[model samples]
Target: MPGSLEPLDLGVQIPYHFRCPISLELMRDPVTVSTGQTYDRPSIESWVATGNTTCPVTRAPLSDFTLIPNHTLRRLIQDWCVANRSFGVERIPTPKQPADPTHIRHLLTQSASNSNPYPTRLSALRRLRGLARDLDKNRSTISSQNSREILVQLVFADTGSESSELTHEALALLVLFPLPESDCAAVASNPDRVAYLAQLVQHSSMEVRVNSAALIENVLAGSRTAELRAEISNVDEIHQGVVSILRNPIAYPRALKIGIKALFALCLVKQTRNKAVSAGAPETLINTLADFEKCDSERALATIELLCRVPDGCTAFAAHALTVPLLVKTILKISDRATEYAAGALLSLCSASEKSQNDAVAAGVLTQLLLLVQSDCTDRAKRKAQLLLKLLRDSWPEDSVGNSDDFVCSELVVPF
Candidate 1:
């Protein structure tokens, strides 16, 4: 009835039963209520959500508004649409079975109890994964079951085999969902779980690795309790996994950003800086910054700023041959913020010894500072650079240092 024959374009006529009583459109996710009438799930849900007690069709005082799935009718409707594809009717997909808390608990229990190899356990994990990913209700359903411990056990369980196909699947489910904070904490709870993530960061597919790093970073940012924060920080492998991301040359830019954020978060706690340094964080971050071939300078610089906070962190930076040079190179070449952070790192690293001070001068930092004082850098950066310039000028070997006018603060290329 809605189509126009004169224009020679007539849409297929939809059946009345296929139409929702409230919305007057083809039913998607159709459900039957107590009044024996079917309607689209969203419309009925909205009607009930608004506190209406009576059924739309019957106006009856429906004591029970349970939305029973109209599966048989849904199947027939899908079949009809498929049969009439030539009429421009698109087949509806088989809707995912509605989430059941009972079923989720049962699957989790089975997942825990089964001692069989991965095939049997994988089946339940796959089902649980599907339900968790398909809808928010399912995610809430699984979360309410307090499934984190179960998931962690499955994920970190020692399979003893080389191929971790099932572990990877479970990891994917854990990382790819909007899970509860408590659930995410379980991933960082113990050394074994943290080790699993570190291993994944090294060997798993890019998606899984990225998600793993991100999950660690997220937990760092928003873990619920103080004890949980301490627990997460104590795991050394979490730091290793984050460092590995920056160390990986083939990682994508977004993954690299997430990795840098993890470092930033991890570096906030004083106790964790030693773990980061032990994880080769300084070297990995230096390489990441120097990888002009494919790098994110903004986050790289910010992470370096955080890493330099620890004394051992500074020692690590100074030990790396390229660390000072890379920080100097980033000045004025990348963003102004990078320039500020680069200046900050130099201040932290070279401010102590006469030899390190001279090394900063040799690294073209003096020239960069002169330019920074005059360039469009941030005010904070300009002030710091000027202070460093004064420090270097005072510390310059006056006898052999050609002339005060030679270091006369002209704009130079900064020796990137």
Candidate 2:
């Protein structure tokens, strides 16, 4: 038998001869023995089930080594297990500190002093950055209303005489802060706040414009108010600013990218549909389709993609100057893969028009599509051809059977 255990005079005493082999710390999962020998919980459990008759360390003869855990130790084990299982990992605890008004004031002051003022000292900048990171991580800690207010204040801070850098930072901060629906409601409720964002959409710097576009997207995602949607729709100066960028060949691609993103944002609002319709957004889109003919193949394809997204009702205008034949000829002329993709888009527009659809069928659009379908080309083009054929079959007149040679292909007939 092992000698009686000695009592050590240590300030802090831990139970068990061996630390928990699993955790490599204190004996968390504890088990008691018949001879009152205690072992790490997991070790004892394993031994009890295996019908071991003696202690591994003491080697004492054991008649009945009942494994019972200490209540306190069991609770700790349960809690640790739950936390591990629930979170799937342990999280490092962050120290709690009182809110520092001075830090907030300093950030605001710096923002006011420079158009793009960041912390001067490396330590301070790191700390500020850390705080921003913490705020992002613990966003649920603050109420939605408070978070939006703080974000709005940050957005409004004036950075000294340099407007560009400061504006960029402010916009960056706006994008970084994740606000809830309630917060968006609070920020958008205020006309002045919405107006401030509208102004940023027209800011001189492209960086600012890009950031503003992102902010608008975030705001519109949660917006429900018709009045707010109408206000945004009516911002002609901002729209013109965006349009001017799109019209400039040198800068248009970048600007059009932003404009398309912003338009997507506005489309999220149910009320903005009428506003877009009223603003002749359809006409603008049609114009883009026409402009595609003059642009590079890649750019033309992008323009076609954007044009397809124009509201469905806008196809009524296609019968006038934007005839189906013109679009088909344009598509047929280009040999690039992208131009082939644009041809698919043009087909969609042709289908959209009541008059154009009839004209397209008569003018051998189906024959051309069948040839493209059978050609050794991209899967995207082939898939588009399949879709066009399906749409044409569904739309074909009852008496229009056996009129076209292209429709008589073996593969097409099998499917039909």
Candidate 3:
């Protein structure tokens, strides 16, 4: 027995037509899509679940979103599984079919109906969430059937009540599943949505706030008009909500990321930048950097660089002690892109105020700049670092440009 030959790793090959087009796995519960192509149930449902309205194999637009079960094919697949059992292939279990559209429609009507029982509404919401979770085809059905309005309505109702449970589920679905452009535009038209979302940021739980921020980001990204976003971020409450999330020590990393991205989007307006600085974005940014991993620091620095272009931005960033040193650390260390931001931020500070220039020099920014210019950073970073270096040398003539505690640069030929 010890000298017996071992079996090779080669396994049985299944028929090409029997394999799912998307996942290339044996189709356990094969289903025919609107495009008339067959795919495994979960795989096809997932394709539609991602908000796509097309068939994976056919690449044809799905005018019909319904999925038709292939009972005959499934039986054949089962027979194959049984035949291949000796080859170590197990039978693929039958997957439960998604709820019928009529059932989903009835639940939607009941949930949106004014006189529906609260318990019934909760049950319908749970069932709707389940339907949404099961199939991408269902998302198309929901969106096309006007149930997106109901989902949005539920998210809008996410008050600090028992109904918040429903809202949380609804919010996840809206963000995870892509909303129709019309749906996003419809929500954007509602002027109160901004303040409404901000209230959640202030008073809601961390999950709700994150969902709200993501929704806002999504809505903003889907818009066609600058006027829409300008009006959205101009409100003090909305601006503060975004900054508060940035400064929120306990906010999840995703919340912080979306919040900063939202803030960046809002700061495109000159009026909003002043509001962001007034809302204490600079200090919060400094605190964020102290604990941020490399990725977060790049985001924070990019925001700082953007804000630093204005006079008030320079004032706010210069007032913070970690602003200069942090910029120095991020340069030539985190990433070339971050180094570019760091250099741009330094240039803004030194350009706006003489005191900031001297402070940057004292923070070993000069040596960092020399290293940054010599390092394999972007052309923009090298140029900004060189400009800031010249400005520092001209302003503080006696202060050695390279002879700092961080590094000596007497022999370092910094290209002027």
lDDT of each: 0.72, 0.53, 0.73
Would you list the rank order by TM-score, best first?
A: 3, 1, 2
Candidate whose TM-score is highest? 3
Candidate 2 lDDT over 78-130, as tens digits, reads 45434444333232222233225456546544444434525442233234445
TM-score for each prediction?
Answer: 0.57, 0.44, 0.69
- The RMSD of every model to the true structure, in order and in angstroms, is 9.4, 16.6, 7.3
List model 3 lDDT by residue over 175-245, tens digit each. 76656667777777776665566676565577677677778777777777876766666777777777778
Worst 10 residues of 1 by lDDT: 1-10
Query: Model 1 over residues 166-218: C-alpha lDDT tens digits?
Result: 77676766665455676667655665665655666666576667767776777
lDDT against true structure, model 3: 0.73
| Model 2 Cα shift for residue 186 (angstroms) | 2.7
Please tell me which predicted candidate would have the highest lDDT against the true structure. 3
Alpha carbon lDDT at 294, candidate 1 = 29
Candidate 3: list runs displaced more than 4 Å.
1-103, 130-141, 153-172, 177-190, 249-253, 290-297, 374-377, 395-416
Which runs in model 2 stand beyond 4 Å of their true positions? 1-149, 157-165, 176-179, 224-231, 234-245, 248-254, 268-271, 277-280, 283-355, 358-364, 367-400, 403-416
- Model 3: pairs clashing at backbone N, Cα or C within 3 Å: 48-136, 49-136
Q: Show the colliding residue pairs in model 1.
A: none
